[model samples]
Target: MAPKITVIGTGYLGATHAAAMAELGFEVLGLDVVPEKIEMLAAGRVPMYEPGLEELLARHVAGLPGSTGRLRFTMDFAEVAEFGDVHFVCVNTPQKHNEYACDMSYVDAAFDSLAPLLTRPALVVGKSTVPVGSADRLARRLAELAPAGGDVELAWNPEFLREGFAVQDTLHPDRIVVGVREAGGSAEKLLREVYATPVAEGSPLVVTDFPTAELVKTAANSFLATKISFINAMAEVCEAAGGDVVKLAEAIGHDERIGAKFLRAGIGFGGGCLPKDIRAFMARAGELGADQALTFLREVDSINMRRRGHMVELAREAVGGSFLGKRVAVLGATFKPDSDDVRDSPALNVAGQVHLQGGQVTVYDPKGMDNARQVFPTLAYAASAAAAVAGADVVLHLTEWREFRELDPAELAGTVSVPLILDGRNALDAERWRAAGWTYRAMGRPRA
Candidate 1:
């Protein structure tokens, strides 16, 4: 029989992790403090928009594969401690209020609640991205709290799944990194068992000490954020040099060393992960008294943020400065395409900025309008891009949704008050849009 696994905190990470574990043929129990979340998950409903997650949940939650004992959801920590052989702490560590430091309260609460219930020997794995010392602290806490005392082993296993590709990333991860104490245990073997399918499919597994594992996640996010800011910073230089940033990026991408994955020169990155992770990483570095080592991230963050201000400036320039009464249409709201999560979304931030500057901003997103409204309630939301662009002075293509890309420029030109467009994602076809009698503008491109 497979080991019984319990996944705590059923947000995006926990939800996908729990589902993937069940699909891996484990008797999985998912626990959350929120009763509504557990109730919803138990009934085969996902609270957010992630592709393929809902279908996977529905399939497993209906009946546990040939038997009725498949995936289970509960709010009780005691029940989880009794059932699970390996418990995964998958809680979120979001940024604190008005600071770059991560709020570790949720992670602490998970350990506080579940540690006392461990009556016997069990493995506790942390999948959340945390500071370097978190795993060491939790290991000591588990030793003191669990009835099994020193028998409870702790491991750090950080997740690298992006929001849009959470399910796929979890089921078929790029690599697995596990950090354990010097005493050592069967964590690697158990994790190997848990991820047999992916391992067989050619995913590498890395094992190391606690700090290295913790550093890997923050380092990865920081690199990604740096890549994005690097391109956006080039976009600024391109604007001054009257050169094309897209062509520059394409040229640099041919080097193989500077691969063109996150070279998108747009309004910059903002989601639940990149922005917060980089900030938290910087904060952690400061706390560790090695602030000089990570000081460059400050510029990376500033460059990314400056792109938003650049978009607003472009918008102002398009409408002859000072948007006192201009009608502006924003094409998308979510940070990126394919996901409806709007935490620190750049598109919505631009919309709000434009609205605050007296521009009548009408925003439209295929899926992010509801979430965007929840965050920016004062901004005008339209049912469709056509509705948003109706009688608009300028159109801002902020988020690169496929629906927005597929939109006919000629059709939009006919409806809008003006045919001027600012492509924030650099996704629009220049020749096609220009041929349609619309003035097309994009970031990192020579002005036409």
Candidate 2:
């Protein structure tokens, strides 16, 4: 028989994990402390904008019409303890306020609440990204709290789901990593069985000790962040030397060794994962007395942040040296397209900065309006891109949404008071905008 699964904390990770497990043909239960979230998921609706997540949830969540009736939701941990053979903790570990360290309060509280309810044999798996050696401490805590004692086991299975491609990533992961204390424990066997389909379908499964598994997630994110910042650093040099970064990236990307994955030079990376994960990794390294080894990450962070300020500066320059009384139109608010998450969003950060500097900023995003409004209430918002650019002195393209790219530049040129635009993401077509009687300026590119 397949093991019944329960996902603790129905946020982005947990909600997607529960739905994917059900799609894998297992009975699943999802738990959350927030009634609103649970109620939303129970209705087969997701709280945030993630492509295909709601459809996946609607396909299996019990009580929904034409559903698989294999997934359910609950608020009680005791019910979760009773119903599941494998409990996956998918709680968030956000960065601490004004600090580089990750806040483990949510991860700790989830274990503290659920471990005491394990009265029967079960495998508790942690899917949250935490500091190294966290699984070791959590394993001990599980042993002390569970009434089943030796019958309950702990495993660490960190998640690597990207925001835009979360559903596909979960159903058919690129790799599956599990950290088990005991070499041949039931926890390992159960997880193997749970992921057998994906493994058989060609996803590699790597089994290792707890610390290595934990480091894998942080290391991968740091590498990606570094790759992004590396190109943006080149953009800085190009700007000083009057060179075009886009052509430079295209030339270098041809080398098979460099591989052109995250080489786009623009406003830099910002979202829930890359920014916080790198900072937390640095903090953890410092605690482990290896701070000097990762000092370059500080530069990586600085370069990334400098891009936002640079964009703001470029906007001010476009509007005659000051943001005062300049009507600025901002296209894109979420960090990236296909996601509504505004946490540490580069687009919103730039927009907020411009607003703070007194640029009468009117922002427009295809999907991030509500979240962006919550983040920056004082900033002006528009119903559409056309409305945003109407009577604007300058338009800033920050986030590269497909909708923004497909927009007719000629139509927008007719709306703005001054047909001057700055492409912060370097995603817009310079020729197309210039042909429409608009002055298109981008970082790292020579103005015609």
Against the true structure, whose TM-score is highest?
2
lDDT against the true structure, each candidate = 0.90, 0.93
Q: How far in Å is the alpha carbon of 435 misplaced in model 1? A: 0.9
- What shift in Å separates residue 195 of candidate 2 from its native position after superposition? 0.9
lDDT of candidate model 1 versus the reference: 0.90
* Total backbone collisions, model 2: 0
- CA error at residue 385 for candidate 1, angstroms: 1.5
lDDT per residue, candidate 1, 1-448, as tens digits? Answer: 7889999999999999998888888889999989889888988888888999987887677444543347889899999999999999999999999999999999999999999999987889999989889899989999988988987889899999988788899889999898988524587777778888998999998889999999999999999999999999998899899999999999999888999888879999999988989899999899999999999999999998989988999999999988999999999999988889888888988999999999999999998878998999989899988999999999999999889889998888899888999999998898899999899999889978
